[model samples]
Target chain A: MARKQGSHSDITGPRVRDAALRLIARHGYAAVSMRQIASEVGIQAGALYNYTPDKQTLLFDLMRGHMADLLAALEAADLQGDSLSRLEGFTRFHIRFHLPRPDQVFVSYMELRNLSDENFAAVEAMRRTYEDALESILRAGEAEGVFAVPDPRITTMALIAMLTGISNWYRAGGRLESDKIEAIYWDMVRRAVTA
Target chain B: MARKQGSHSDITGPRVRDAALRLIARHGYAAVSMRQIASEVGIQAGALYNYTPDKQTLLFDLMRGHMADLLAALEAADLQGDSLSRLEGFTRFHIRFHLPRPDQVFVSYMELRNLSDENFAAVEAMRRTYEDALESILRAGEAEGVFAVPDPRITTMALIAMLTGISNWYRAGGRLESDKIEAIYWDMVRRAVTA
Candidate 1:
């Protein structure tokens, strides 16, 4: 499964990143230290340097990986047609992508404070790329006369916000299954867009 | 403007809370300290205690007051309507309430970890109350056959998520005016459920 990046380090890197995610999610990123992340990973603070060069790098790696993974997942999903259909696909893909690994989502949202100025701008650019993708779909739908919206850009942000909110409240043992949760969001997304 | 419930201590309490919020919003809550807040307030850290008992109290107080203020604002808007009107009122009210105080919104979202168990529960309860109110409006709309939603609870959450995301990105000098922002959201919310 490993490429130029060794499976050993790739796998171990995520492990450390996961620990940092949970720590930063539970305690704000500003309060976390490299020593604390190292302790969480069952290694000496000095050992963490093997996986990541420094604290900011670790945070950047996690966020960049997360944004990349999300966009890749969206691209991988074979979704097309009207605005409503694309939105349904998005809702389903988003729930599947985010709900399973909530700590990662929480980390990505809250740990932006840890990124250096240059890194933050880069990640934010990626984040906007995803939003623009959604808007592109909505705009196409409007052009095709399949969906009607006063403002496609605002709708895109609204839809994302609505979909991601699922992570804040969804629980593994909850009454609804993940697929069911996806379906629920898809229903709203479709309704929100249908002409 | 201060009420009788306000004392010298009470007068300073809000100043101390505001300083804490600005710092916590700029830096995460865990990284912020009572002494920092005192310094920002231009008062001694010891005087800061006289306003708030401790750091935890200050965090919780800011969050709780935020939630309380949010609910009160919604209640006060009292904008009359059928289900759609009520929801629009909520959308407008939420945007207006959040615009003036981005830092409070930031703290409410980012500082939940700092809240003590009792404090967290209280804020959580109030949040649910606001959510439940919205959910009930959806239910009423469903009953009246004026709105269509697959799940009232999920729809409620989706709307709240979309509304809150505004605070994350909206800027004072942005191309979109605040009223335009509100109208854009209102269009989405209106189309999302109206039958």
Candidate 2:
């Protein structure tokens, strides 16, 4: 059946995705069923099919959408200026972008094994593209003699992992303010990359 | 039922833990069943109870065992010398210990949500002790003016996360040798903390 613009699908589509992300994050993709997701969304089990064909597609969609949003946000951040400035920007941007989305971060990383090989490749390629963004900054800094990157690829992964790990323990009203956290991490990132 | 030492229970215990680790790492604790675990161990479902009281205990055991092993190994590393030396030792030791046990690392981090409140606290305490080992080094380095750490706790977590992230992608016979990988990570760890 052809549905009109912004119909039930449009309204329930986001609800479905949000519910799937929540359930999958809490119980893992392997254990979470589409029926559970539908129940969480206050819909009948069969109604879930209207939004996605199966649990796998729902999972793939959640991950793909997350990456797409991340890439879009990074593009919008428009990190500019010299390599050092851009590197700092990337460091802060990564933390700010990922810190609040703990569920998404958990589900995306934890549920990768559940994705089909083809889906896994797609998500991985998107991830690689994101990593390339940081590696490019490292390369630019290396070329400018501003950063002593012995291994740019490894440096990129290490820095990203370190920054992304904040989500594991950070709380909104924790001991440190977000700005202070960012500043501290920025210092380490700067010193690590530079001489 | 009394069992003799080095009998069937002793032999089957390790197999059960190994199978549980493998299955849980691949499918997650929420999705994996005791029956499947028993099947994987080539034992009857009922006999699986002889190994563990229930799945929660099994998961708690797996996680507790991983952290215990990590702590014991860290103690064995006997990191001595100046703060810098110990820090380098920690950087290398973390990578060496975690890289080869990807499954354990995966379950330890990913299955934290599935752990019971008491189990979670127990594991968290053990993990905290390990982090303390590194934080003490940073604290010492700060006192000696060898390192400039704005936040010792956050720094410890960040460095650990960066070093442990190697397990996510590092493979034996990969492009970089383990020794080379250790050296590269050590450089970042050193610069990231030092002035």
* DockQ leader: 2
Candidate 1: TM of chain A? 0.90
lDDT of 2 at A26: 87
TM-score of 1: 0.93
The TM-score values for the models, in the order shown, are 0.93, 0.97
Estimate, for each residue in B1-195, the C-alpha lDDT of model 1 and write its tens digit.
Answer: 546576777677678877888898888878888889999989987878778778888788888888888888887888687988888888888889888787887778777777888999999999999999889888999999999877888888888888898887788998799999999888888778877
Tell me which residue pairs clash in candidate 2: none
Model 2 lDDT per residue over B108-174, tens place: 9999989999999999999999999999999999999999998899999899888888887898999
Query: Between which residue pairs do clashes occur in model 1?
Result: none
Q: Candidate 2's C-alpha lDDT?
A: 0.93
RMSD from true fold, candidate 2: 2.1
State the lDDT of candidate 1 residue by residue for A85-169, as single tens digits: 7766767777788888887877787777668999999999999998898898889888888788778877888888888888888
* CAPRI docking class of candidate 2: high
lDDT of each candidate versus the true structure = 0.83, 0.93
Best by TM-score: 2
